[model samples]
Target: MLPRRSRLTGASSSDRGLPNATVARLPLYLRALTQLRSQGSQTCSSDQLAESTGVSSANVRKDLSHLGSHGTRGVGYDVDHLRAEIAQAIGQTQDWNVVLVGAGNLGTALAAYPGFTSRGSRIVAVVDADPARVGEQVGDLSIESIDQLETIITERSVSIAIVATPGQAAQDVADQLVGAGVTSILNLAPVALRVPEGVDVRQVDVAAELQILAYHEQRKGHPREEAEVSR
Candidate 1:
């Protein structure tokens, strides 16, 4: 069970409505802290963390402040305590059972990698439309038919769905997931999804990210000759 936080006066602040930018950078801090913990480090000052993550020390301090974390004057923040607080603020303290909607390449990769679920989210079921892929072994899971989507989701009480289906099939699978009571979706398909009012959807588009990086590179005096090489 997750530890309870008292919302009384002087209690620790929660991450319920953190600014978007701060919330996005929290993962970087978490990763840096995790690395420090693995290295047998005892504690980390803000400057050390800033160097590890390439963020400024002042910015790191400000971000940690949002989580109500105040490092000691000299000794700095305790690595383990800070990690646990950040994890709790991010809701990683609770177990999240996810239903993966597609068993294609992206789905298989996500399923095969246990690191994806090491924190708190676990892919409890894998679903695919292809008969050949169904019943295939992925790690400890056997790919199940798409026909079992509703049953598996409901049985596991899954609230998160990963949509890695083809671009054209994404919306249909998302509709099915919503129908199956999935409130949040991580869509890997290269398409925009339309979900109901309360359902949350996060899309990952590698091509789009590459294009954005290219734009920045061009602005930073990247020569036109580079375009020819890239082409």
Candidate 2:
């Protein structure tokens, strides 16, 4: 399967001038820059950024070059300036209202996560199909009926949604979200969503990720067997 491109990055390489790899790494650069800024770092070299982000200095320079940033010969990139540039590149400068669908355990936790606001996307509403959950509060916002989904989205001008429904209900929730004008979705359900061309879906499957880590652990546990197989 082809890797999904994140809408948070604004545009694809085809639309913007950056390569796919550079676009993906922009977030890493921004994160490292954020940490540096917090530490009072005014300027940072390519090597410093590469070390912080676990990317090679050469790749760091190459990636920054795509943004028309070539650090000074003796100095380096200004941390504040780099952060602003990456923020603009990734559409973090703009506020993105998001709606959370499904008030189950996963959905509830997602609604309370503070990282979304820090990343420029805030969950403005939460909804679920369960009547019992409708009046419950996940954070500061009271849960609403899933029947009010479209209304909440339109009223808030929400363009992004988080789908934390069960695997069986994921597709349906995705359909509703798309129909309500959501262009981007962060899906935590196990099932993959099928949306139209313009819509973007990014799935986060914790169990699947853990299984991948288990595969690597198995390889480490049987290193001799793995080596023989390589032969």
Top candidate (TM-score): 2
lDDT of 1 by residue, 1-231 (tens): 334333222233444466667677787899899999999997999999999999899989977877777788999999998998788777888889998878888889999887766677899999999989988998789999999999999999898999999999999999999998999999999999999999988889999999999998876776776677878
User: Clash pairs of candidate 1?
Assistant: none
By summed lDDT, the worst window of 10 consecutive residues in model 1 runs over 1-10
RMSD of each: 5.4, 5.7
lDDT tens digits by residue: candidate 2, 97-184 = 9998988888888888887787778889999888988888889899999999999999999999999899999999899999988999
Please state the error at residue 191 of candidate 2 in Å. 1.0
What stretches of model 2 exceed 4 Å from their correct place?
A: 1-17
Global lDDT scores for all candidate models:
0.86, 0.87
| Model 1 CA deviation exceeding 4 Å by range | 1-16, 220-231
